[model samples]
Target: MILITGATGHIGAAVLDQLLKITDPGEVAGLVRDEAKAAHLKAQGVQLRVGDYRDPASLERAMQGVRKVLLVSGGADEDGLQQHYNVVDAAKKAGVACLAYTGRALQNPATLANELMVRHFQTEEYIRASGVPYILFRNILYMDTLPQFVGPQVFERGIQLPAGQGRVAFALRQEMGEAIANVLADSRCDNRIFTFTGAATYSFADVATALSELSARPVVYTPIEQPAFAARLHAQSLPEAVIQRISGFLTDIKNGQEATVSTDLADALGRTPASLQEGLPTIFKL
Candidate 1:
């Protein structure tokens, strides 16, 4: 059986959907923390296994009878690395055949110089040492998360961020989901790292133009100082730790960390991945 962690989430759900098409639904198990959120998946004949990354016993139970597992990376918390270790330890103990992890596209040195990348690298190292065949999907930034950078006042207050002229190879989240599912289904993808990315790169200015075109509103990209940006986020009631983490992301972008473009995703999916222009409409609900 194939077990997927975070199955109720966007990437997990998409992977589940794609997996169901090529495999028997009963052969797949979804590790979920909330059964209520997994109602639709359960109704579709997917086996629901209650599990939490922080709970090793639960993961051990979920991994029973599971040959392969997709260990989706946890959220941006200080405990995330430990949680990932917990999953890896459980997977090792359960004798899982293959373990796939979703991580960041770390091409530039600038990208690796942040707390986010540090944690990912740590997890990758741990996974490698776990004695299981693994696939690392080093994904680029998601175009779906552009709204967080553009802010809610984009149409009215225009766009503002600390990222200055930094381009990102932003891939569509759903397409990424499909690509990940494709990897899990194929045996040849074992013990490899895939850089899942879009066909093109876009800067914030380009993003503003796209938003302007899509929303038919005057959207302008304004470069702001990091301190000012932090202050603004603070005024909005964001935690200091969260604000610092977000600022570090912007710092990486400003340093041109996320600018690399790769065709690995296209090669994996057997087609050119969607660019920002084609994906913007769907993401912004235009």
Candidate 2:
């Protein structure tokens, strides 16, 4: 049996959908805190297990009889690392065949300075040392999240970020989920890492051009300083912590951390993942 955490979320639901096609729905279980929230999954014949990353006992219960488990990354608080350790510990105790994890894509992750980015690498280290067969899907940023950076009035306010000219190999979230499910269904358990990415790399300037074409109006790209960017977010009433987290992400992009492109995503899905041009329309509702 295979279990996917955060089954009710966008990526988790996408994985479950693809997994159901290649494997029996009865062989799948969704780890969710409240079973009522996953009634839709249950309707699709997926078993729902009540669990929480912070609750080790709940994870143990969810790991029961599961051969493979997918750990979807989450948590914004400082306790997040401990939560991930709980999941890994529970999976190890259950003696699961494999433990799959969704992490960030970076060549030198150990050199990362961001708080959350460091946690990701730390989690990867803990998983490797746990002595369990594992697959690390080091995913890039999702194109779906581009809408947040673009805001509601791109034509008028234009585009502004601290990312500078840095590019990202942004993959579609749904395709990433599909690729992940493809691996989870396989029984190989190679204990490998896959650079989950899109077909091409694109910068924010390219984003402006795309929006200009879609909106039939001039859309400009303005690279702002990190402090100014944070001020803008603060003007929108964003909390200080969220502002810092977002700024860290922009800093990483500006540092060229997400610039690398890889065909692993296409290889995993047995087809080329959607390019930015093809995916932008759907993501921005154009």
Candidate 3:
């Protein structure tokens, strides 16, 4: 049996969808924190197991009879890391055969976002040290981020960012999830680190241009200083920590740190991932 954590989330839900079509419902289990939020998944025939990453006992119960585990990273920050470790420990005790984890793109030890990368590396290390077969999907930034960042302003104003002319290899979350499901379904996916990306690389300006075309408005890309950008986000009632983290990510983008694209996802899924154009309609509708 295969167990999927974070089953209510975007990528996790997509993974669950793909797994259902290829595997029997009885062979699939969903580890979710809130059973109420998972009513839809339950209706779809997934065996629901209520579990919280902070609670080791819950994880053990969730992992019962599970052969493969997909450990989706929690949403919170440092506390989330601890929760992930707890889940890994429980998975170890449950004697799961293979564990798959999500990670960042850069394998390089030196980079601005390397700190985030390190956390994922630590989880990967734990899975490896546990003597379980593991697969690491080093995912790129989500193409969905474009809509989240700019969609709100589509009708009122335009998009603005600190990413000066930097390019990013952003893949669709659905595609990433599908690639993950493909990996989990195949026995040969053990002990591999696959870097996932879209078919093309895009700059912030390119994103604004696409939005402009889709919305039929003058979508402008404005680059501002990191401190100023953070101040703006702060004025908008965003948490200081979130503002700082976003500023740091934009700084990394401006430094050309996230420009690499890969064919690994296509190779894994036997198909090309969705493009920005294909994803624009749904994103713009919101």
Each model's total of backbone clashes: 0, 0, 0
Candidate 2's TM-score reads: 0.97
Point out the higher-scoring one by TM-score: 1 or 2. Answer: 2
Ranking the candidates on lDDT from highest down gives 2, 1, 3
lDDT of 1 at 101: 92
What is the lDDT of every predicted structure here?
Answer: 0.87, 0.90, 0.81
Q: Report the number of the highest-lDDT candidate.
A: 2
User: For residues 107-225, could you state the per-residue lDDT of candidate 2 as single tens digits?
Assistant: 57755545688888889999999999999999999999998877888878899999999889989999999999998998889899999988788899998998888868899899999
> Candidate 2's error at 264, in angstroms?
0.5
C-alpha TM-score for every candidate: 0.95, 0.97, 0.93
Candidate 1's C-alpha runs over 4 A off are 108-113
Give the range of the ten consecutive residues with the poorest summed lDDT in model 1.
Answer: 106-115
Candidate 2, residue 158: the lDDT equals: 92
What would the per-residue lDDT of candidate 3 be over residues 104-198, giving only the tens digit for each residue? 77535466743554677777778788787888888888888776565476556665777788788888888898889888888664598889988
